[model samples]
Target chain A: MTGVRRKSGSVPVSLATVAAAAEVSISTVSRIVNGQTHRASRETIERVRGAIETLGYRPNQLGRALKRGESRVVAMLTANLNNPVMATVASSAEAALRAAGYVMILCDTHDRPELQDEYLKAMRSQAVQGYILVTNVKSPGLAEFVARGEPAVFACRRNPYASGAFVGIDNVGAGADAADYLWSRGCREPAVLFPAQSSSTIEDRLAGFSMRLLELGGRCSKAEAPGLSHLDVGYEAARSLLDRASLPQGVMCLSDQIAYGAHRLFFERGLRVPDDCVMVSIDGSTLSSWLAPWLTSVRVPYHEFGRHIVDLLGEIWRGEASGERILPHAFQSDVSSDFE
Target chain B: MTGVRRKSGSVPVSLATVAAAAEVSISTVSRIVNGQTHRASRETIERVRGAIETLGYRPNQLGRALKRGESRVVAMLTANLNNPVMATVASSAEAALRAAGYVMILCDTHDRPELQDEYLKAMRSQAVQGYILVTNVKSPGLAEFVARGEPAVFACRRNPYASGAFVGIDNVGAGADAADYLWSRGCREPAVLFPAQSSSTIEDRLAGFSMRLLELGGRCSKAEAPGLSHLDVGYEAARSLLDRASLPQGVMCLSDQIAYGAHRLFFERGLRVPDDCVMVSIDGSTLSSWLAPWLTSVRVPYHEFGRHIVDLLGEIWRGEASGERILPHAFQSDVSSDFE
Candidate 1:
């Protein structure tokens, strides 16, 4: 049995108390308390208002019930925060989350599935209302866990089996797009190099590119570098490819990191990009623009994608209907023979 | 006059009831109920525990006075999440907090003091057991503002006034160490370049280097480029620094960004690092090692320093003495250099 002191005052009226008092949803209660009007019915509003008055429930998620009058914290769980792509996404996600009167709690799972599970458990333990998953690792528990009625969303990578909430570009389409672009650029025989990491994700991207290249009447050769080869795997693979008796007409790298390493090797070997060899890679990183005549690349919509994940999570928190969300990937194809 | 509901009945048991039943100090009753036990006498503990059991008085802050299984959540506030050093520190702090079974609510204030203030208010409102401030912009409210007296700790930046608890490297000493190493390597009459961002931080580092240079009988010239020149202002600064009719024999860039630009220029002009133009920087970014031949840099004590910040905050939360925590900076002098 629990009771509040009348002398000191009833336990500070909170959102939880008000939601319990009103026969309405959390988002509905939040909207009413925040003075937002739109979808709420007159009868529902009247009932909620009546409950608030009788219970003397003061809105707490605002600045008043709160001593300082603000609680705009947002918690984001990112896969591989060390990866520059995810880092870029997180940077933009914070920007958008802040613009929407929310702060972010960024958790980097280091692309470990078990660690991701631990973080999820921790988030639930803390009652974190929103979640953004940015990773390529496939975890069976993730989609189910987030889908089990929570304010959660996925970014950058999506689970094919789950439906109801995700915001990301078409990785497969992007891979195929790269292949098509390379083939169209007068390349007859193309070799694809992907670093071995996150089997599911690499497969998705590679499948997309492979499908397109085969359809475009171009021969496709695939190379998967052994061991951990994120970002720099392409360099080693490229060196080995060049040292081989014959070289493919063009090279397609999995990420900009691998491409960067390859570029260095080319420089070391007195070879220029797109001259002795035409190169293309995904992710328009900061270095891509600075490299000599610049790289022919497809820029991941990090800014938009990041915002989409956060915004979708907010929608879920606001009690939007459950479902899958796939954001479109904007392609940057301004790569000409524009090398100096 | 807050009270607890009775186990057998609905009637409330007040603090006075416990005090009367225990025949002890009302202050003692209050302290035990609130979970503070440092001042309570042993006999008083037995009396208060017995009284609380008899009267069934429940404490709010001290609610569940048992300490062993108590799980806490610490809200940590930081400015730039994208900055590698800050990112590493946060990662380490989160690990430490997690290992201790504490949830870390990380909020990025994004260099906005107003937002930082708002976040402080939010954390207070959330009733976070404690807070760890890792902000870029220093404010008066930072060192203090613990009205509820919830423990507060700082990381990275320090409270130079020596008022608040701090866990960071000795900025001045790190600067001096970098300078001493550079000069000992045949670098003479070195010029300094900084971000021109925060005068306090810039001056702190520059002063240490300048003081040491003067002590070494070498004249130090300084230049500050306005705006975000560390990244963009580099080329111009390098051009000006190098194009001068007479230039300093060596250069010390305040950051790897500045050093990268300067070195790029040096390369263009056919000058070599540590040979014709010895270059050194602080905040050892990954760019330092990945660059060809690497860069001479002063690596901030990230691992050790990060661990200390979390440990200090833990100590503060545990009701230990709260004071300034001056951490030592580990200097990595082997920053890829060739000296006589």
Candidate 2:
């Protein structure tokens, strides 16, 4: 122990070092170290034990967990942190995990399945306790891990194949609310500007809005944004819409980021919100109000989402439940009240 | 090994389990497990080895690193992720660390020194190789850790006590540029809206702007925002400014987030940018251009900062350099060309 303590600032002492110092077989040394002395003679045990004390080697948590089967660490997989909404979710999730005595290691896959797989593999090798996903798309190998009875929770997004706890907003209902607001305001021609992605949340929002608008005797034209970036898509979509002979009286944006882009284009084109057209979007991030004309958005209930995600995680942690919690959404009217 | 494998999904195999299976002393088992077998006899080594295979006990990375005295993980401590600048820095830093074969763990301090200290302790317990700080204030325990010869780097902010590697921008120069632009636009009276914090960057920017404006034959008045949230501060500051008999011809905002709040207040007061008052702020985040009549800002060299931070970390990792890198800031003028 004195020798080990003296060299503490240098490389750690290993089991082999102890065995070499004790003049015993590695197996006999392992038995002596693990307290299974029935096989080892007393004299052999003392010598090996003395060597361990002399080496000052301590067992690592990872090795110790080989007996516990769990590490006090959780891996959070996010598509990207560039989005303010994702940042909010991440902050909330991290705080919750920390409070629960688990360290969170965040992995940004940059919306790539390969990266997600790589991170998952790394986390598995480390034997993390569970996973928390803030990804919109399905991650490879995630289903297999969950199938093997690993604890997992999906926040803000759904996994079609996994049977795990989920906490998210009602995207379809939020979309319908947006359409209802525009239609009730006497918008006969409404348009949908959505990113070209297969996200269930985005699809549900578009579906709910389209269905509601159609029911209100309005035809909703759909325009697909060209890229994954909400801002770029909104800009490109708006540019294409401007090229048309007629513009829609109302536009429903899929996200606040998209709304910002579309709003910028509208401002540049000398069009005013609610004067020439109106807009309703989703994801009521704090930045939603940062723009000149605050967006009329379906407030995604981020706080609620954050709370329920942790609550549901507790359920999974305690093995009490593995179900979905669909939080509600509300439409906030920050756009001008007057209608032509 | 078979015994350990059978209970793999349940519990891990401990040193004691391996020792009992090998019929050796715990100390002998420890020595063999840690690979310190030089002292162990050939027969004892074979016995301990046989027991390890029979128990199916695998040593974890932490155990392996007990000999190396460090883990392959690096902890990144950030004040907050809500700031877009922070998110960009994190993404770049993560990529850099991954390229160098180190896993990065993110911990949000929420601008709280207590949280910073807590995370620092946790990372130390985990035996992380180093730290990367994105905080504006000095975190407790950080100074001691660096003093002990541990590798650490500050990104976007610095700790006064530690002579560690730092990567940040010239806040004073950026502030002077803002003042110069607004003054050159022939604005005689200038006002400042800033967050009330003891941050060195904010202090330098305020000083640089105030002093330079004074040198340019103009007076600059300052207003402190209400709370820590930059948006609220900007809003409150703008409201107070608007309450006066007259407003300044140009406004210098401390940050883009603050500018957003001020912009909202101005929009509500029917005060248009460039027409009512030209404005300049720090942090050229995407939102800077998302607003109507995009804000003119002292673009933080986030990409440059990120690159240099990683470069410096590489130097620290290689034990080559331990110094500071001050990247220059550029003023992006989108507030109108007539400023000159």
Best by lDDT: 2
**Chain B TM, cand. 2:** 0.78
Q: What is each candidate's DockQ, to 2 decimals?
A: 0.10, 0.25
Candidate 2: stretches off by over 4 Å: A1-67, A292-294, A333-340, B1-60, B333-340
> How much native contact recovery, as a fraction, does model 2 achieve?
0.35
Using TM-score, give the best candidate's number.
Answer: 2
Error of 2 at A24 (Å): 26
TM-scores for chain A over all candidates: 0.71, 0.78
The per-residue C-alpha lDDT of model 2 at residue A327 equals 80
lDDT tens digits, residues A1-340, model 1? 3584222102445666777778777778778877886779998888888887887565433233223312355567776555667767787887787678665766777677787777776655444446777753656556546445545666666653465567766678878878877888888788888876654456777888888888888877766665343546766777677777366778888777777667766766777678777788777665444322335776776767666766676666555664555555544545322212
Colliding residue pairs in candidate 1: A63-A69, A74-A103, A164-A323, A164-A324, A165-A323, A165-A324, A166-A325, A176-A209, A231-A257, A231-A258
- Tens digit per residue, CA lDDT, model 1, B136-249: 465544533543344667776654334556776667877787789778886778888776556345667788888888888887777666544354445457777666645566
Model 2 residue B118 CA deviation in Å:
1.8
